[model samples]
Target chain A: MTVDSRSEKTRPDRAAATRDRILDAAERLFAERGVLAVSNRQIGEAAGQGNNSVVGYHFGGRSELVLAILRRHAVAVEQLRTDLLTRVHPGSALHDWVGCLVRPLPAHLAELGDQSWHARFLAQASNEPTLRAVIRADAKASPSLRRAQEGMFRLLPAVPAEVRAERGEMSRLVVVHMCAEYERALQNGVAPPSRTWETAAARLVDAVVGLWLAPVTPAVLGPDAALRCRR
Target chain B: MTVDSRSEKTRPDRAAATRDRILDAAERLFAERGVLAVSNRQIGEAAGQGNNSVVGYHFGGRSELVLAILRRHAVAVEQLRTDLLTRVHPGSALHDWVGCLVRPLPAHLAELGDQSWHARFLAQASNEPTLRAVIRADAKASPSLRRAQEGMFRLLPAVPAEVRAERGEMSRLVVVHMCAEYERALQNGVAPPSRTWETAAARLVDAVVGLWLAPVTPAVLGPDAALRCRR
Candidate 1:
């Protein structure tokens, strides 16, 4: 398969290969360092193109490259998340819906075959306005995303739309933090704190689902619930 | 009062002033543009230093400078968060605790005046590893941070140590997102989507608090409670 090309003057296949190599290197380097710390020249070197202009020529600049990395990974993640949600049996329970939400990451990361640098990349990416906007725009158009949305709405039918939106947003933030924790663990030379990605995924899914499953009356929510739940 | 000095130069006062001026300009630029997009020379010029050496002289480099900005604001935020939490009447309700968490941003942002740039600076700062590490380490030693830890612990007494840690991290992420939303709104040359800052703060606070306060069941309190709680 050919990668898309816009900035390079080469054979279509060569241009595509060069572009993919640049993005691959850029994503990994950005995760290891950061978007700001890595440079166009470094990305070019890592991709083996031997041309500093490749990043600018193909992606226009670092910002645009970041946008490209974001869009590319978002498509992959978006599809995986969608596929998992769609595979849910027609009448899955909230717990099953929760499973569908959390279970896919490890599996997908495994499939990524060490190219899963995007997990760390995402921790930083979620904070970038340009990248976040691209991801959000694509998500808004995703049918699978709509299905996930319906899954949440179905799970929290009693909750108001505003509440649902808030919950959904919080859930997304929790995932971001979880990935950061995982990234941090990996960086520290610690085996993933999560035994199997599934276990870690389970914890995240359950914690979030527990947050919304609601028996919490406004008055008795905080320490009481936390302590009570722990005990 | 003098700002912090450069480690290299013996001119503590001049170095400190230059450092503060650099920080001032950096914070402003970060808020107006973003950490990823701005550069050291621009920061130097805006500070009226007219020298590229300022980045290396005062803060070691761009990344450290970002850390300085984060450390500076994190100190102030921790203090305000602490002060707000302490005055909680002996028997404040959960909502009161939630309020303690949310109300200070706008209040402190106002007090910050020119330094209000610190909020958006922090929003982007969370993504920078060197900066994130510095702020996190510094936060661990900050006295004002105690109230947040204890307050959240009080609020979620039933949660285990690990879960509490996760919740605390999530709470911080929520704050970052709130800061980002405000930054984005301003970036687009519009006021925040909420009718008022207070209204936005209230909704965001409620959403965060609501997640932690979710109800605990016998299932949640079982031998597998910790495991189940992840859901």
Candidate 2:
């Protein structure tokens, strides 16, 4: 091959590797600290990039950088969700569908092993307003996630739509924060409550099922009745 | 009184006001941004302190500042908890005990009116390692909180202690993050899932009661059986 062709052939590969390094560094820093806490300069230094502006050059801005990190993990997690979805059928119980929603991320983290930072990074991202919208939009784009959500909701016909939406948010918070806590525990050399991610996820699935199945109390509006509502 | 005596008396009042300003500014910034994401310099500026060292001068470090803000809100929340606990008796139902655990913060926030940031601030603090420890220790110190916890656990006689602990964490995560989300939604001019904090707390109490009552699935260890466990 010509020298120009040889250089051209390696260019994309080199660029991909550089992008991966930056994403890894950014994810770790964002997870360890906070999403808005860490800066591009620190990310560049952690990634071993000579140019401080390399992050900006590659990712454009903070939201784009966060989206890139999320998309990187989402591909693997999305595949896990799809795999789980195949096992779920029309006759599946609520727990099975909930597993489709809950297990993918933990299962993905399990595959990533001890070095994974995706859970913590996503947990931090979920707290930031702008990044939260980004995550919601991204999750909405995932057909597998939507399917799992729909399947879980299908089993809860007795639940009001508004209550389901609220419980959905609760389930997301529990799963995301709990997984992040588990990851943090492992990294800190602290013994997590569960022996394995599998066990933790199982426990989470149980609590979430309970959360979804909980009875809703109707709101009683008015000042005089507000005091008596607690009883 | 003489001019000197009057000036001396006002000095202490002025110092208290300054500290309150710093605490208010720090809490809002930490809530809007992440805890570690914000700097003392930013906090001081937000507080309208001309000197950059004002935050450090008032509060020795970041943890101290966070603790100060927490303690400021805790006094009010603790009082609300105590008041709620008075209404909860040994004969009270599971929901009553759960209400004791869940309602105080939301009640306190409700009293704080539309401008409250404690929920979001505490939510952010709960995510940070050192701050999470600080929060746990603080909560453990509250007599009313311990009483409420014991009351709730008493009703769940069948749940394994490990599972109880796990659910307890889940309850805390759900309450903290859900309240935070509500606060954020209110601030963003969006309609929250629940019409009022009172109703939100009611929903949380219901879910937490269900969570504590969830059936535990036994963990089956071993690589060969692991894949089959999900099925």
Predicted model with the maximum lDDT = 2
The positional error of residue B161 in candidate 2, measured at the CA in angstroms, is 2.6
Of the candidates shown, which would achieve the greatest TM-score relative to the real structure? 2
Candidate 1 interface RMSD value: 9.9
Q: Across residues A24-143, which tens digit of lDDT does each residue of candidate 1 receive?
A: 999888776656667789888999987778789999965678778766766666667766775576587776676555545544554564336877776666666666665567557767
Instruction: Give a tens-digit lDDT track for model 2, residues A4-42.
Output: 988889999999999999999999999999888898999
lDDT of 1 by residue, B16-54 (tens): 788888888998887655566677888889999877877
DockQ for each numbered candidate:
0.14, 0.61
After superposition, the stretches of candidate 2 with alpha carbons farther than 4 Å from their true spots are A1-3, A192-194, A225-231, B1-3, B192-194
CAPRI verdict (incorrect, acceptable, medium, high) for model 2 = medium
